[model samples]
Target: FDLWADAPEEATGHQPQHLPAPKLALPGHEESYNPPDEYLPDEKERKTFERTEPSERKQHWLPEKFAALRHVPAYEHFVRERFERCLDLYLAPRARKNRINIDPDSLVPQLPDPKDLEPYPTRTAVVYRGHTSRIRSFALDPTGQWMASGSDDKTARLWEVATGRCLAVWQLDDVVEHVAWNPSRDLSLLSAAAGHKVFLINPKQLWDTERQLNTQNLLSTGFAQAAAIASDEIMACRWDKPSGEQSSQGILAVLVHQRDVKQIAWHRKGDYFATIQPEEADAPVLIHQLAKQQTQRPFRRTKGVIQRVSFHPTKPLFFVATQRYVRIYNLQKQALVKALQSNVKWISSLDVHPQGDNLLVGSYDKRVCWFDLDLSTRPYRTLRYHRQAVRGVAYHQRYPLFASCGDDGSVHVFHGMVYNDLLQNPLIVPLQILRGHKIEESLGVLACQFHPSQPWLVSAGADATLRLWC
Candidate 1:
């Protein structure tokens, strides 16, 4: 009865009181379920697990709860090993992190560097001394081994380019105004303009002394065999004359104007040539085809006093230079394609680049302008280094070089690069100034040309000498 009475206090529906919910263990309570040192993870393992675990999971489990879980000795080692694996995955070195090496000097050899160009015509290697009168025109043979020059001496002379030795000379009836070597590698022919007639000279016949002597004897003996042989050797004695002219004289071709033909440019294929007359403002520019020996007027009438004409290196186009402007005509379309504007009052000469995308123009204002046909009708660069008017300009086919001669008695060499991309600007570097020919009175260097394949140049001047610069 008494025991039941003592438990009477719990007889109520509620259980005994929880001792005020067992107040939280005091900071230094020893009997309050303390974890063993080995059972709890070390400071290093705890920090690693904190760093490697996701942020949301870290907020869900308190640091005390993690410590309580690691309180199990077996579980503490497993937790530490998991943290170590995560560290190795993120902090370890990778194979793809290797460094790379590069070299800067590996550029294509075909492309020329502007810094390597030397712009001085310092070497006067040889002086060709055959022409007695002022040499007006000069041309390099296809092989680049020989040069042909025409002068006021009424003769066209061929000389060895390397030695300046005169190989042969052909006497003409009038002053040799212009000369051009056949561009064909298979043919050794030359064309010379004098007075109203053009002569097609065969170098083979001129080189054969026996043939010349026999021809002379036959002419003297009045034999038909000699005349037939002379006719065959000379090819066509005279170029086809205009329809109005009746006589078939012993001449290769006839100029539209009775005055001297100032300039002649051969087509790239050596099939035709163009001629211009300085005095004939009313006459049209004449184009003579070799196969037909016929002349056709490309321009029905002259635009202005035509100074020079040049055929495009690879296109069906020709350029005409007048006193004030340069015009490009399309041969196939038979129309004016472009008219290049110029600030200079007079344009003396122009030469087209082999790429057929640019032109080099020389003018009387002492300016040498480089015109980019694809960019605009205006000169891309106007260089005024020459003291006097520029007389002639020539471009090298295989090299990124060009030459200009002027009345100041100087020849300037420049490196011009026409890049493949339209966005890239052309590189023009003035490399050298060649000065050897003396300026006689007002006349200076009349013409200049580059050897086809060699690093040689030939300049004709009023001094009656053709100087070779290498």
Candidate 2:
């Protein structure tokens, strides 16, 4: 109502408002048929017009003189002049805009120096050499005491992380594709993916009697129910107990898949684990529950070739990485949460940060992409320091560090500090490149992971060795 501004209209006189130039204006002497000599451009002025950019030029056309109106040449830019005139009449006048004089370097976020973020993996500390063939994958136990490695030599070996001593070896009939230690320290169990089957092994010799017994009961509790169910009921996988030599090798139960199992990812709780069979079109991914001995097909129909799978660190989210995209699914709601665009040709591996707010993706195109989950689906940073295909990537569980390894036989370590403030972005700094393994058959480092609790990294390579960097 009038009460709002009636007093201000008189007390504060109406502020003067600047109006734009009128759209219609009379042509000046430059457009006259018989213009003055001062209005015409000289030879030097014509040359300057030719050298200047079209957008920066003061006049669209040069002025010329004529003795008589009838003798004047037809306006060469007549059509262009008409079009510009029409545009001015129809469009609103634009205000003059001044460019921001910002320094390119000043726009960049300030990050701490790499030297200040010390204790990252710097030099090779130990090399565990026992695998006869290239190591496909390896994982460290939650306690950081032991390491399990799978290789093409059809063997899975356990090694003491500190001493690099091979404690035990379990021989298989085919190449071991992947291996992972159960996240739960009480279970002390290891899962290894081989040709068409995933073996659950509990090396009782390395664990105490109570832990061994607990693992056995958990694995064997569902045996009766699994046997009662028909094979047709669970078309994805079958849980069966190994016998004789395989049983003596500490193989608890073998999960038979329709095709070769390429990757295995254990849930944070250790009872449920997911396996990937790239060649299996119908059921490429299967989630298995240890206590119930149940295998579930997460997707009825799959998209691109499944490269790898990872479980969220603290949530009921599942991360499935295809050739070019990483999709996160909500297990409880059975809905898609987000599809992270890696923008890489072929994703080789994936790892979620321990905090579960960030993702790291390695690609065969020699690129490493980092994604902040809270930010957007696109990668926050894309790094291209690898000379060859990036085979593996990992984040330190305790330290603010991440590393990527490739066929160049070098591991590039980076200091990735994620700030607690949501407004503040992550600071990434290149720390060091640890190179020791010799390139063999064009394949260098196959996999890399950090110690669970320490500032150490263990890398498995095609050189048939695992190097420790601290």
Error of 2 at 305 (Å): 0.9
Q: Write the per-residue lDDT of candidate 1 for residues 1-470, one digit (tens) a residue.
A: 67655565556547743332223335332222344445445689667767775644432221232245445343334576568667766676444334666455554235455457753345898988978889989888788877889999898888888888887777777888888876866555577888767666546533546633442332234322222333322332233332322122212233334456777788878768877766754453677666545556566577677888988887898898888789998999988999999778888888899899999988988998899999999989999999998989999887888989998899999888789999987888777888999989798999999888876778999999999888
lDDT of 2 at 140: 92
lDDT of 2 by residue, 331-438 (tens): 999999999899899999899999999999999999999999999999999999999999999999889999999999999999998988999888889889999988
Worst 10 residues of 1 by lDDT: 242-251
Error of 2 at 320 (Å): 0.8
Q: What's the TM for model 2?
A: 0.78
For this target, which candidate reaches the highest lDDT against the unseen true structure? Answer: 2
In model 1, where do residues sit more than 4 Å from their true spots? 1-115, 118-121, 205-257
